[model samples]
Target: MPRRYLFYVEQNYCYGILRPIQNVLRSRGDEVAWLPVGDAFDRGGFEAGERVFDHVREAIAWSPCAVMVPGNFVPGFIPGIKVMVTHGLISEKRRKKDGVIYSFIERGLFDLYITHGPNTTTRWRQMADEAGYFEVAECGWPKLDPLFDGSLRRNASAGPVIYFASTFSPRLAAAPRLFDTVARLVAERDWQWRIQFHPKMPAAVTDRYRALSGDRLRVVDGHDTLQLLLDADVMLCDTSSIISEFALLQKPVVTYRNLSPRPYMIDVREPSAVGPALARALQRPPEVMRAVAEHARETHPWTDGRSSERVIEATDRLVESGLGHLRPKPRNRIRHWKMRRALRYYRLFPTR
Candidate 1:
């Protein structure tokens, strides 16, 4: 029997994470559609022939069997088994006080949490056992299927290409502090610089970087972030989860004051140090490259590009087995009320 699935998106970058899975779903004659939750998502990013319902009510009417979410939360009222396909791999983005990573937090909004690697699987399995309301399964992230399948190409550029990215958070973001340094480097080096910021990055900061766009430096909207990860020779980033993606490609990454600096990254302290760190990254030191390989092993062991297939299989099996073992999810009345008000969806028994 064919299954209907909904890809619930709330951010510009979530498209990359969900699209590959859509391809798998369609190839198997299953139905899939996207639902851009709010204004935060860019409608322009939607491709031709992709089905999207403008309202949450219509999505409820569609009767999807599964809802794949890349962002934090989705209305529990929506039909189907809610699956959390996280937006990014783990990185240094963490709480300043206790060094707790945000991605590990369970929002109680999902029935299934897809694990990209063993570390995540172990942690979430423990959480699942404790919560008794969700399930954790290991199936590599679908976003990198193209990357590992040997489909993406390293775009031809005259000099080494450097991808510069930053988290949107004011405290963790490196763009604000390194803007002048980046400008000077763009002026000095022939190195091709590609800047892609988190979707929520303030316009003032993005605008300054966009102004630097020209022959050598261009600001990418990050819809094609995975492509940038494939093409760039070195990644210059700060605390953003993108660091893990770039490093998974076995490329050198230059991180600025990363909370947890790993052997794979060239961690720098100041703006003045970015250039030298980038230089070192470009060199691709044997030790760092070796660490990069090991990092890939630990993060996502599957390079077969069949993670999408695995994810679908796991989801189907779970559905067939039923949710009998797991306990009921908490009502979360307050959160559900907030979601209903925000989306203006007051329908109680949403068109079963």
Candidate 2:
């Protein structure tokens, strides 16, 4: 019995995070389609055979077995189970001011929360025990499956490639403050430099960085950060979950003004410290490799690249047990109104 799964991608950059699992589901002879929310259809480069829905209402009419999303917002009134796959691994940062790290679990929006590791799973279990709203699965991140499977490797002859990635949050992003410093370092250093910004990053900010691109300095605006991650020997980031993902490669990461209370990577508060950090990361990698490896383990333990398989099995079990149909359908008029307003604002829904 073939089942249909819907992947709701609200951002273009999320394609990398969901693509691997989508492929896995399809390979197992399941029907998979994509629901590009808002401008995702314009920005997300979805391929052929990947059925794309023009409207959320239309997708809701189809009522697939389950719908998966990387973001927080999902319509609770939908017929199928709503799964939260997570867009990134940065769970340390609190979305609220009250210091609640796992608030997403309390929202009662998702039927299943696919966590990346034991650490995250433990937290979700505690939350589930309290709310009893969703089920938790400790599946490793599917995006990193290729890296762990040895299918993706960097060419040593390319010299040291330093990848600079940042979050879109104004308070957390290092791009606004470190652009000039990075440009100078790229111009002076012998290594190749690649800068990739969050898809939601302002156009003005990206344009400023684009002006600094040259023969050795590459500015990437596309959704393909996986290639940059695979090619880079060292990564420079700030408060972004990409730091944790990059650390899984066992390479050195230099973070600037990380918001996480406990530091995971080489912390550099000032722009001047970035050059020294990069030098140390490249020249003496073993000194920092230990901490990176430890952090990687804590972040995600499954390095065998079977995370997608685990996710597929979990989905099948939920569907087979008919647990997917038990998800709560709360009637919150205010919430529905807010969602409709947001959809209209993003031009995702037709106006009355």
Candidate 3:
């Protein structure tokens, strides 16, 4: 019989990863179930969780050898093999809450933690080790598979439009200066500026920007951002993993950092004050843009877009091991005590 599997979605947007994985697995005749952990009711349907843990436990009880959850879902009670796939390369400071929750969950609960990219895996391994997680893997992020297709990235003769993948944190919105800078840029740019807001952003702010932008600024809803990225000339962002995706496209990206009232438990970099200066540089020659583009390409290296394949292979290995009940040998008592003490010590630190 095909192996049963449970896939947990932290939010609706996670369909980016979930859809592709589901497609690949279902094609192989595996039985897969999708669990939405976020507020799905507003979007359309509701997930009825009888007990808080029922959602996870029932998925486990179905005899699934492997359960894949996002970083947010805690599978502490699931008495089976578990793996977590992270979308963001969050720093410990930004993900303190997740770290704390993982501390509780990683104590012999999860067998593997899969990161979005190999570089992200390198960045997060230290923290995972510190948190008592040892079975970490650099399975590439499965979300960028669509971009690898040749037809998806053909540039228009008119040149591609600039896409702003906005993540409006309450704190960041409070910064009037950033808004003013963006408004000024929108007013000046002859090309189209498409703004894609996070679903959680307040409608009022969006309406206000919409009014200010007129025809040049467009706000989109329920659109596939991957398609937008494929057609975009440049991507303007602030500390989102979208930056990494843009890098894969080998396009120009300008990241803004100096915003206030940041998002809860998320780390963002400040955009260089030379943003306006960079705009001037953009006008002068392609040289400046070329330099920045090169840096982005170098910084992020999963451009072959084979991350999904890596993720699938890692998942298959876990499924095989879990089906066979082949976990690591039990630790000696003294080592177990030491690990317990380490968990307690990390708990003492502030959590997001």
Candidate 4:
């Protein structure tokens, strides 16, 4: 019998992380349904196996065997087992009061955690030991499989493609501070520029970059950035995990005032230094490539592209062994209220 699975998509852009797993499950005769948690489906225009439901009530009624999410919160009231697959590589960006990479695990909301590498798996195992609620699986990230499998590769003749990406946070974002400098560099060098923003980035910030788009520069709003990563020759970013992702490609990366500095990347304190740093990176590929290799090994250990298969196998073993049937942790009223408010603001659930 095929196990029925529910995949929650809180952001349309999360498809990049969840799609590979979904495809693997389906190929093995499991049924997967995509549940759009907010206005993400409408904005992202995602198509899936069944009718998309905007309300949690409808999803809970379906009684799936397991529910998988890439985001932080999942409704505990639902009978299905809640599985958390990370939305991105664990960057050094802090999102919690304790300076943790994310707030997802602190609440004990998930039954299973699918981690990207040993670094993340070790942290998650420590958390699981403390919480005594979730199980941890160290499957490599599913999204990067294409890059390793040769299905995706950079166009060598793409005319010096420069990818500029930013996080949504005001404190760490380079888009607001470096757009003009980037625009000038693109025009001056006649380089092909690709600018991509985080889905949560403020409309005003995206608008500013969109205005810089021209014959040489393209402003991309797609949910999946893997293609963009494969297309670019060099990457310009702030504190985004895209820096880690691009570094895995063994390419030069320039960071403008990065909140967290790594030995592998060229960090510039001022926007004026971006062009010079990019020039140095391009001119000195051997030095940068060595650093890129070290960064890639430390961040992601698996480059064989079998992460999605490992994830599916882990999920299947848990389900078949009935370990996924463990009761969800007791609900926290305060957290539920906050989540409801956020959903209502996004028009995903009713106000009442």
Candidate 5:
């Protein structure tokens, strides 16, 4: 029998991580089903619900393994082998205002935490240890598909681009500050810049960027970020895993997390210590291209772009082992309650 998966996807936002994994899983003969938390969140008009928790519980009961994308409503009651493949392994340097809802997940509910690099695993392990549970692994970043192959290409327009691939967080104030500076710096230049904001970010910020609309300063929404990075001449970001993709392209990438903690992440080969060393790289990025190249190799020792293969291998191993005991369920039932609900939906909404 083929392997079955009940994957939880929080729509729009987790496309980068979930989409690639879905393709790989299906290609490997796994029957995959999606429970879109994004759709659920929207349906509730952004309000929280027990339905979200109930859906996750159902998915876990049906499949031996369930991948829960972070930022969705996590299952508080289910204590199965909840595996977390982080959307992007980011540093705590730039804290979001909403103290990571899932931070407390370390409390004995999860079994494995897959991370892109050792640095991230180390940090999370400490957090998990503090929470009294410790099981973390470095499986590399599976979503960085473009980096593994030279499949992505630059845009047809051939216009110079400044890609803004970051979500606005108050902790990393340097990011917005640098963005404004770059906007002012490039406002007069002949080149064009595109700003891509995080989905949850308020429209007001995007509107502020739009006001600076010189032919060069353009505010855009919903562009394929991977394609944008591939096409752009230079990328300016802060502590976002997008840099890992940029490293694979071997492009000129400058980071703006100067005020944040020494960002320990995957593919950040070079030490981003402050003063002349960091400033010079930002000012003249091409000059440090060689250093970035050398450091990327050291930082991502296994990052030859075969993350998808590794993930595939890991899943295959799980299947072979008959899936470590299914995510826990209420003892009285054979089939999970959510599966029953989903069947009802299929029967009623069959054509629609």
Candidate 6:
């Protein structure tokens, strides 16, 4: 019998993160479905033939064997081995009402942590020891698999393409700060420009970029950012995780006052210096290229496009071991209440 699985897309970026894994699942003759969790996500991100549930009842009745999440939380009432694949591999901090939280922090919502690389694997392994209920495996990120698989690449552009993406956080966003500089650079250089902002980016900022779009330049607001990264010769970003993703492609990235400028990145504090920094990155100097290689090795050493397969393997191994040995997860009353309220599932007991 074909096993069933669910891809829990809490955010639009989750589409990119989980699609590769979904491919592996379907290839193995396993069934997969989607449960999108928020209104913030764009429905256009879904492609035809991809099965999506309209509500929590649809998911519950299907009773998938596993649920892969790219975001932090999942409804425990959903039947599955809750797998946390995480949203991004960046070391950025997210500020919450309580305090600053890193991605590794446990939210008592998952049974497995599919880590991207050695750095994340090590941290998640340590966390697993304390958590007791979850297991951690260092299966490289599935999201980057398409970049390796040659299935996602676009045709080479007529001109050198520069891809620009920015975070939405006011304190860290460069879109607002470098808008004029980017506009000027676009005018000065004949190079093609592709700009994409974080989904949370203000409409005002996006409107400004949209107004500037033309034949050679575009403000990409869809879910095909991986395609944009492949098309670009160099990436221009703020402190967004796209910087890390682009660098992993063994390309150069120029940032505006990056919070932690890696050697692989050409960082500039002043918007005026943006042009020169971009010029340097475009040159692909030996040092910058070497640093980009090193950064990729440290973060995600798998460029072979087999991470999705490995994720499947890891899940199979965990299932073989069974869940009886693991400790029980906490009740998490308030969190479960919120999920039930939003997803509207209030069954007294989990069916699976």
Q: What is the lDDT of candidate 1?
A: 0.87
Per-prediction TM-score = 0.94, 0.89, 0.70, 0.88, 0.67, 0.94
TM-score of structure candidate 6: 0.94
Q: lDDT of each model, Cα atoms only?
A: 0.87, 0.77, 0.55, 0.78, 0.52, 0.85
The digit string of per-residue lDDT tens for model 1 on 81-102 reads: 8889878887656666876777
Candidate 1 lDDT at 99 equals 68
lDDT tens digits by residue: candidate 3, 1-352? 7866677656656667655676677778777776555454133423343112225335546756666766544443334456776655432224345534221233443567776544455545775566543367775566666676342564553433667776756654322325666676666656666778777777776776677665667777763678788777666666565665665565556655623212211123543352453354335346644654554444345556566567667877766664333434233345444433532322221111
Poorly placed runs, candidate 1 (over 4 Å): 95-99, 349-352
lDDT per residue, candidate 5, 1-352, as tens digits? Answer: 7665545556554556655666777677766555565343333322232223335446656654544444423343332244566765443443347565332334333445666665465667786565443345566766667645666665764456666566566554333455456555564445567777766566666677777877776666662467776666666666555665665456556566533323222123233331223234335454467655654554354656666566656555553554234343222222333433543322221110
Candidate 5 error regions (>4 Å): 38-61, 68-73, 76-80, 92-107, 121-135, 156-159, 174-183, 238-245, 261-287, 302-304, 319-352
In model 2, which range of ten residues has the least summed lDDT?
A: 343-352
lDDT tens digits, residues 90-169, model 4? 77777667766662346767778888876677878897777666788988888888888887766664477888898888
lDDT of 6: 0.85
Candidate 2 per-residue C-alpha lDDT over 62-112 given as tens digits, one digit per residue, 9 for 90 to 100: 778888888887775445677888777755677566777642445656778
Name the lDDT value of residue 214 in candidate 2: 78
Per-residue accuracy of model 6 over 240-313 as CA lDDT, tens digit each: 77788888988999988888788999999999999998888889999999999988887899989999998888
Pairs with backbone N, CA or C atoms under 3 Å apart (clashes), candidate 3? 116-141, 171-260, 171-261, 172-261, 256-271, 257-269, 257-270, 257-271
Model 6 worst lDDT window (10 residues)? 92-101
Poorest stretch of ten by lDDT in candidate 4: 343-352
Candidate 4: list runs displaced more than 4 Å. Answer: 40-44, 48-51, 103-105, 156-158, 200-204, 324-330, 337-352
